[model samples]
Target: MSERITLGKTFKPHWVWAIAFGSAIGWGSFVLPVEWMDRAGPMGVIIGLWIGGLILSLVGLSTGFLVKAYPITGGAFTYAYLAFGRKHAFLCGWFLILGYAAIVALNASAFALMIKFLVPDVVKVGLLYRIAGWDVYFVEVLIASAVLVLFAWLNIRGADATAQTQFYFCVLLIAAATGVTAAMSFAPETSFGNLLPLYKPGIPSWSAIAAIVAISPWAYVGFDTVPQAAEEFNFSPAKATFLILAALVVAASHYSIMILATGLAMPWLDLVDLREIWGTGWAVQQVLGTAGLAALAIALCMGIFTGLIGFYISCSRLMFAMGRAKALPAVFCRLHGKHGTPWASIVFVCAICLLAPWFGRSVLLWIVDMSAVGISIAFIYYCAVAYRLFKWTPTQRAPAFCKETAPGKKLIALAGMLCSIGLLGLLLVPGSPAFLETPAWIALGCWVLIGLGFYLTLAREYCNTPKAEMDRLILGHAAA
Candidate 1:
């Protein structure tokens, strides 16, 4: 009976073990610096180990509660569809693809930059060609593009390989980061007090609040990926939620340790410059010397490679689903009969990702923000759907978590939506000063326009026909 289900049961119903871990490291690694700078300061950086450790666990606990209640392959997209009609579902899915793709591109680009940094010889002919009294790396596009391709290929080959590689790399990263921090903290030259905050600052000031708001809640970004593996988990909601919560705790611990070690080892000024923030290779070099750095670089490459593969797999699946719905070219919906993979969609997704890095110098940075904003919007839509399910949907049953007409569930859902909406709104504000030059609103509008156009085209015939004629025609056609 289960074999006849629409979802493939070949793969066990386990939360995406590997993808989740990769996302944790990839998303949390960079976010550590951002969060450390804002919430911890120099002292906050060191103390972030303890404070952030606690905070992330709480967040994981909360998210686990919700995720257990709803487990579906499309993540929040599936939830939105069930509660809200097809229109809301379509937008959420579209935005999610855009967001995840952007993030994958950005991460690839960053990985490339790190590679060049660790091995100066990787790029030949480094000359100071001063353009307006500034030196820029000339081979930016070549390096990043190469990284994207390499990762995409790795992902297309297999999922199991990707998972194993990521698991090992994660272990190494944690080890290397730990070693660096331990040395820094214990070194006679190092003063741990400098890394400690004077006080908690009682209540945060408006300015401080603004900084936190602006910093982006990256700590919470990849939680959406949880639901996408609904069909793959091996447990009930209770068990799945437990696993998710466990992963988050481990992830939080790993990141907090790294941030603390980094703060203790490097000066505040040293850490502030994004360029100075070394990739896994350079970071290892600084702590463990040349040989250590080389080993770390290899590990870093493996990690990045796996990340690319995971992104390709998930995004292609999404695109394939969309294509099947005729939201995209039907060609993308075609699958490899033997391999059982969406080979066409994979190629298309990888090709699109390859092109994104060509958007000039700020490609990586822009990609992250673009993707982040898109994901936030998608989350807001999800929250809206959840609320609707709890409110308007007469047939909707309360999940195990939210059973009664409890005001608390309503508040949580409302808060989640409001928070997501507020961030998305801020991103879209034209006059609002932000990190990027292109207005967020413009980018968002473009995505919306493109998605809506496809949707209207797919539903055009039905939308144009009158209700009486459609009913009569259906009846006549059936009788015939």
Candidate 2:
């Protein structure tokens, strides 16, 4: 109800690219390529990513247009509210929070996993109970907990702090990637022959490529973070829209190069035989020795750190938006007096991160797989909102850059909706490459039930209030 609770304008134009690109290229960039290569090979990885990128690009286009019109903090949730209603918005925000929280947990677990590789004894310091085949250690959990608190503090300090950190990490990641690509290109040991076998043995071509496509949403998840922080961006809507597109392009290029460089550095069969899940690092060590491997580790750490920061920013803002709308408690909407950051939401995200370590590293993959489904669900809502917004009367529509691009925007919205539906089908259909396991489905169901409980209990009071009174109490604006 107060102006003080609103998010401040602090993010610059470049930070848009940094946050989105940095988030998209997180832990997955470091570890998933081997799986991608194993499924399809270097060419398959490239082609699959390009295909997935094209689909997500449509979703991105719809997101860009919607953000330009609404320019709100909630991203998909806000769009859903405008097009559908509060209930649909709540469900959309609920699933998105699950996806964002899961990602935050995944990155925290990855940081621990990476540290275990870099300094194997750190996890051995405090022997904790093992769950799902991962040996949980007190020290490993402590380190992850510490990282969560540190990132939360940085975000609580201000959006500028988060953006600055994202920018630096992204730059370092790009520089390291470029160095690796250049080094591998000229290295005597590097050979195109290593990439000779383009597909894994016994796997059908379409199935292999489809496997990569199934995971595509996880690879390009960060671009939507731009819209999550739209209110904080210090730029025109059109510039913000272009930044989203540019970030996707940059992310796609970085992923392609990284996959290619890793393949060039070593024989795929040797990489498979090494049994190193961190194949990218192993490849760097093989090609450039320990020094290069150290650099690669640092770059990878930067990637994970940026991801934690970027997703924290997104999660906190979404919670803040939900709180401001009175879908959750007002405490979540309350901003820090001096810093103007969503302190409560940051702490809430930190709490979720603290719980993740107990599940161990193996569970992190399940979390990532589950998050892919949750994210796709949110995208479906976003596409639907885009479609509805495009059809709204001039007087009902918010100011947007859609005037000249109306037809294009409509097509993108339609395609995004269809593609998102198809993705969901891929995840749910039996025997589909992307189909999630039973445990993962159960976990997702539990999360959704928890969200439903919160909505039913906390949202009722706000729903019962008069529309005018509710707007004033929640948004500090008149009802539409």
Candidate 3:
């Protein structure tokens, strides 16, 4: 195998925690409270989301178990290849790449949305065309594009710098959100009574709760990001699963706090029906006046930036692994000599997201709805690999890390696998509340078609390479 560089060990435990926690929270927790409440009531949203978090805890543990078994980059991609083969790896990477890219774009476009709300006239300059009731504007696009470039550059700079930045951003994000939650508690206009009509009327309380639980896969996605950075951990591999599980708890709490805090600022029913571009922001403004809005702005911006950085790190690292394995053109395998970051992959992700702002807000909502299915597919594959390898396969074939595997780890893997499938059914089934709308279906279809074209082109190249050689490239000389 031709020699290739690897990412260095620079991530501390806290840094990995920040990446997972921050990525999982994102801007969704801050901005989507109103929408989440609309789907499920305020209390229902919190209960269902927490329930989803607990479910995803199982998935995160399964993923972390695999991280220890492999201790390599590429995350689910590497796991898929190990469990199946090259073609499966390509399929996994194809789905994951879109999920990662769409999220980066989703968060980037969200930053623009926040900016538009803060200074409506400021970002409204030079209005462009509109898409699905969302007006596209040059200044808003510029703001979003600029942040995309900035984050891409930071990621390419090095893992050390990027991880440190993520930690501080994560801290500020939590603090900002907590500030609003605390203010809502003391605000004269707020009381427990404001939380009345706990579950949306006409919808069964159980159904409302189950509806949000179904979104657990997407809601808790950032926890899996820990595996993508396992290759760069300065700590022991044994600590990975704990970090992921802990991050999920924090992420779920952060989300719940935001939802409850928003709901308390005003009667949730009144808050839910508002047509304001940002009822969440507007609600916060009402509670603490401008100070509350400022805190929210800080939280939203930090959420966007950290999510952008965390996922870019994951995206570039996944592509780097795939490229090194010859699943992608080797261009992505190249790293900066000084920083040891995947410069090419970062640039590619940044370039794709740069167009997101121009696509308008519809792109943000549609892509997220579409990407959830792709990432859930990833969850299925990862858990399948775990179940097959640790349970059914001969024990001798297991990695050294698996020698002391937990008693019920296999069953947990099975549950994770089934849960992911349920998540898919919830979104794709005809009558489900979480069903993708027409635009999302169309967006998802385009991504699959694009992936198919790329796969056929690369199939010839993948075939020419032997399995042993591909393993060496992807797992390196240390691989058994």
Candidate 4:
């Protein structure tokens, strides 16, 4: 069988590779650790990210294995269906959609926040004040929405077109962020000694390490998103899985190095009023000063643009897959007449993005809480499935990229399970009076509880009723 399949003018490997890089190293790596580092301080942030990154490595590898086994587009939802059952699969899909949608909203909110920093004066005055809040930016929202529409069109027009865009943008973003950050760090005023024993006083306990570790995984968030492009890989899923795992390792290293360099240059102590002092423009100004600040704005604009495109693409794929499997309303699964992309799903995602403005400053916190738990649930599920597969499914002659699912497999799965569980607990801990106060964990619990309530009331038929009838009932309700 030939390895490649055409999706519009888009080539194979291109889309997969683009998403692999973009999804793994998007705004998440660039911005998340900065926020978390402020909380953990430099040393705690470093150690927590190291441990959290290791946990993500384990999950990423397991996801790669699962993708090789079944390289479908729905990611963990696909795996959850086969390993668990339809009910759990639906829950997985629901949470996955919610998680990614939260990401879109988060990015848009970040975009607006960045704009407020860049042009705070104009936004605070006269006509701008009437529409957008004082330092509340809606211009960025409009721009982000426009980008979403354009990318949606491009994605439908040709997968290749979208992939090409992703590749160039990914390279541009990585190089820009890295180059400017490095330039800023190497300035004569920057201290090499600031890297030593950087600490902040807070609730310092071994218990807090777990909390730090819980939050730490946010840096490694999108590593699993690579495997979502499993169906588009040119190589066998086996080889593709290895490449993805390697990417996670490289990405984690890149993040660690960037933070280390940045910490040395602009120690956490000096970052107390980082937001008010540096604002969203901190990263860029750290290197280029005024000239650098302009460049930083340009880079963030691009970063947000690319992030939206990738987010829409992935979420659309997910919704499309669910619809195709009759797990969601069939209309969402519809393709464009000429473009062959999931038009309905893309539109739905855009509609969802409109709600982004409501989140305001709390966007990242919400995304962290929304993503951490749902993803952890998926990770735990994958671990369980891998455990069962290792025990029940005999290993055949393996592909070179496939690791031997020996006793080590079980151990790794166990470790992943424990880590996820522990992190989930720590993340749920309420922030103390002195710390950064975010209500996302509570919000996520409320959200999940609502989902569970819906599951009990309406979705019970999905589990109890006949398959055909269940699909019909589910679709009918979703459509209604």
Choose the strongest candidate by lDDT.
Answer: 3
TM-score (C-alpha) between model 4 and the true structure: 0.82
Ranking by lDDT: 3, 2, 4, 1
What C-alpha lDDT do the candidate models reach, one value each?
Answer: 0.53, 0.81, 0.85, 0.60
Put down candidate 4 lDDT per residue, 231-259, tens digits, no spaces.
55556677656655665666666566556
lDDT of 3 by residue, 1-480 (tens): 578668888899999999999889887887888888888898899999988887787788888888877788898899888777778888888888888888898888888889889899898999889888888899998988988998998888888888899999999998888988998888888887888899999999988998898777777788888989989998898899999998999998899889878888878888877867888899888878898999889999999988998899999999999988878888998999888899999999999888778888876788888889989989898888787656443554565324344548888889989988888999999988788899999999999899888778787877678767777777664334
Backbone clashes in each candidate structure, one number apiece?
9, 0, 0, 2
Write down the RMSD of candidate 1 (Cα, Å).
Answer: 6.5
Per-residue lDDT of 56 in model 3: 82
When sorted by TM-score, best at the front, the candidate numbers are: 3, 2, 4, 1
Clashing pairs in 2: none
lDDT for each residue of candidate 1 in 358-428, tens digit (9 for 90 to 100):
56334445455666666766667666655543432435565432334645545556666766676666556
Alpha-carbon TM-score of each model against the true structure:
0.75, 0.94, 0.96, 0.82
What local lDDT does model 1 show for residue 226? Answer: 55
lDDT of 2 at 417: 94
Taking the tens digit of each residue's C-alpha lDDT, what string does model 2 give over 1-480?
A: 244366778888888889999888888887677867887877778878888888888888889887887677888887776666688888889889988888888787778777777787766787878788778888888888888888889889888977987999999998987887788878999998887687776778778778788888878898999889988878887776688788889888988888877888778867876778478877878889887887777778888898998999999999998888778888898889999988999999999778988888777777778888888888888888787666444455553323433655777899999998888888889999779988788888888899889998887775776666555543345534
